[model samples]
Target: MLNLLSNLICTALLSAPVVSEPANPKALPFEVSAYVTSENKIRVAVEKSAPESVVVLLRNSKNEILFQEMISKKELKYAAKLDMKNLTDGAYELEFKSAQGAIRKQVNVATKPVAEPARVILMNTPAE
Candidate 1:
């Protein structure tokens, strides 16, 4: 029974029609992601299966580049930690570029408000 099932599966797979490829590929050659950490820092990660030159940039709201780095083709996996302590709180942008295409990510940094403690009053005279 196992041998017959294996033969049937192989025959079905072989008889399946082959789909034509699209004129323009929708997927990018590399995968990239970025996010802001609780410690006021931005973390960027990239993964490219093939060797390719890549560039990473961090820009402010004014479109001014605050940080930039060039990654060699030999490095398949890339990770970066951007320190935003010195920079003022505002909207920022992170971009990853390669020969195939480019991708952009928005990063916002805003300080959280601190909550004030509640006030308490004592009534010692009434108790006495």
Candidate 2:
């Protein structure tokens, strides 16, 4: 009987306790969208969710940087428009960097032939 109790106590003492560590969390926020205008100009819209300053960079498929600029905003959302009239038709990428996060998005710009000048007029007529 004494031996059985001793074995039980020894088994309890030899068993290890499970320990858990707290997890570390971090903030991440960034977005980018690209669109081409009717005049063949590429417009890149950048959105940020942080209040800290950020840098927007544009690069081509060859890994060559085309343009870069710094922006600062107090709000959580902000946008920056880039004009690419002189850029060649190809695939491009936009890199967004902030104090908290960094993101990249791919964009494609197609070539358009030159045409005659035309005017666009919007007429609003009230209907019954």
Candidate 3:
């Protein structure tokens, strides 16, 4: 009887399931995303759960406004391509504000230097 009771308790513990808490308990109603494209440009996208007014701004390291736009509430989705060709190599900030909340992202611009090809010389007088 003692061996049978121990076996039943071990089986119950092994068959139990484990539960874990989620990383983010609360969910946001809106989503924002930005990325750099191949043509030296930034692509901004925003999706909202409901139609609401949103303000988007792009500022430089000095907090100077480079570009600003107000999205109308009538639009549910928004996408834009910001030109970065004329921008200097530095830090920039992108901000989005709406009724749900606000979000900010930092971007760094840099240019790679080009390397020159090496030169080679040949001498044929020593062959005689």
Q: Please name the candidate that would achieve the greatest lDDT relative to the true structure.
A: 3
CA lDDT, every model vs. true structure: 0.66, 0.56, 0.67
Q: Give the higher-lDDT candidate: 2 or 3.
A: 3
Kindly list the per-residue Cα lDDT of model 3 for residues 10-126, writing each as its tens digit.
Answer: 210011111122222134445677877666677889887777898888888999999999988888899999877677777778887766566777777765534456999987786
Estimate candidate 2's RMSD in Å: 28.3
lDDT of 2 by residue, 7-96 (tens): 222210111211111121124454555554444444656556655776777788999988887776655555555655456667777776
TM-score of each: 0.69, 0.52, 0.70
Kindly report which residue pairs in candidate 2 clash with one another. Answer: none
Cα shift from native, residue 122, model 3 (Å): 4.2
For model 1 the local lDDT of residue 128 reads 50
Off by over 4 Å in 3: 1-28, 121-128
Stretches of candidate 2 exceeding 4 Å from the true structure: 1-27, 73-77, 112-128
